[model samples]
Target: MQKKLIDDSFSIVLGKQGLDLAKILDEKKYINEFIIAKKMNLTINQVRNFLYRLFEHGLVSNIRKKDKKKGWYTYFWKIEKINTLEFLDKEIKKRIYNLEHLLKSRETKRFYTCERCNIDYSEENALLNNFICHDCESVLVLKDNTKEINEIKKNIIYLKKELEEVEEEIKKNKDFLLKKREREIKKEKRLKKQAKEKLKKKKINEKKKIKKKTKKIKSIKRK
Candidate 1:
């Protein structure tokens, strides 16, 4: 099994510990729905709805297990890391393309704004309003793109860096799976050895019991 690039279990502090749902789901191979609900401090149905949303995006999968005594089914969830990375890759590509378009617009077109009202207008809107603020009835100032454009460019750069990190995590997951498989194989070998020893011990005990019984019978006959 390969690890996914997106930190499904990745939690980001979105203003005071508000966790990103995608990150939380990405970390576990299989997680119980109830467990997720408890961790998020939400109702089971809320967690189920969120999980279903992720499932629609192909981010998670679930397995249902029936309890023999209770007669109800429990669902266990797992992250689909590969699909998640692909989804993210597609999303980032679209964002980058949009940013490129915005950059071109910033470079080529004139945009105006009302500083007081915090309203922005492109060249067409400004022309329609005769370069005036519609809301505050004030003159529209020529908007500066230097700071805003730079910030957007910076964000694009950061997104690319995050994408690279996700790829690294994917590789890391593959190595982890390989190691786990090896460990399981070793465990199976150990269990087989233990079973053989147990059977050997049982046979020895049986033989001893039979020998003792025969000895008792022969002594009773002599008496």
Candidate 2:
């Protein structure tokens, strides 16, 4: 589900080209741009163009490494998963809001349509024209908005549900990242503790060796 949303968000931002690039991008690690181009069967410039578009939207991030031998810099790209999800969330909310607004308009306002010409007009326009079709010169009938209103309502419901799922996915990803950070911290602490212990043991062993050498010299002088 998360993948689907990510793909959709990419497609929305960068179209089909973005979707193709997104398929090869990594969530955790950065991938070489050349490899991405190869996988997508596109030129490096084409891949960069798509990536730059995503970058403009904060959907992807990049790092550059300079090659001493080649005297050039290469970029690696990774998907910003959380940002992508957030973008999708905002987009879905906007869509839902617009759908609700349209639904309200349909329920409240009157619409007139010319059946022959298949043209529609608002209440004010229809009133100004005396409820007559401007093109077909036929009497304009009041359009039943029930079907349109219901469709808008259904779309709103679907978008709301999708928003809920996106929010949940965002929460889960955040939790997973937090847990991963915690594990990394603990591992670092453990490694530091082990290093300290090893150093302490090494010092103790060195001290013991010095003491043994001193005792040997004293016994030799007494003998």
Candidate 3:
């Protein structure tokens, strides 16, 4: 379910080709762009174009490394999973809001339509037109909005479910990143402590060597 939302989100942004990209991009490690192009059976330029689109949306990230012998840079890309989910979340909310607004308008106000011309107008517009079809001179009929209202309600429900799933995925990704960061912090502290201990030991040994040299010089002077 989480994967579906991620894929759907990408597809929403870049179309069907984005679905193929969602499969290729790794979350943990950056994949070489050339390799991605090969895997997708697309030209390098096409792959870059897709990556650039995703990059604009913050759904993907990239790094470039200079090739020492070739003297050119190679790009690597990875999916920004949480960012994608967040984008999807915003899109779903926007859809729901629009649908709700439409639902309310449909329920409260009346609409008129010309059956022959298939043109729809709000009650106010119909009033201004004197309840006549401007094109065919036919009488305007009241539009039955029951079907539209029901369809809008279903769409709202579907989007809400999708939003919930996307939010769940976002939380999971955040928690994983937090734990990974904590582990890295712990490792860094341990390495620092070990380095401090090694330095202290080296200093103590150096001091002992100096003291022995001074004693030897004092004995030789007395002799």
Model 1, 1-223: lDDT tens digits are 1232344222221222123455455446777778878888888887787777667777678899999999988888876766666666666667778887888888788899999999999999999999989998899999998988898889889778766776666567677789999999999999999999999999999999999999999999999
Clashes of each: 6, 0, 0
Per-residue CA lDDT of model 2 for 59-143, tens digit only, reads 9999999999999999999999999999999999899888888888888899999999999999999999999999889999999
Position 201, candidate 1: lDDT: 100
Q: Poorest 10 consecutive residues of model 3 by lDDT?
A: 1-10
Residues 1-223 of candidate 3: C-alpha lDDT, one tens digit per residue: 8778879879988898999999988888999999999999999999999999999999999999999999999999998888889989998998899999999999999999999999988999999999998899899999999999999999999989888888888898899899999999999999999999999999999999999999999999999
RMSD of each: 8.3, 2.5, 2.4
For candidate 3, the per-residue lDDT at 99 reads 92
By TM-score, the better pick of 1 and 2 is: 2
Q: Model 2: which residue pairs collide? A: none
Q: How do the candidates rank by lDDT, highest first?
A: 3, 2, 1
Candidate numbers, best TM-score first, in rank order: 3, 2, 1
Candidates in order have lDDT scores of 0.74, 0.93, 0.93
In model 2, the runs with Cα more than 4 Å from the true position are 67-70, 133-138, 221-223
Using TM-score as the measure, the top candidate is 3
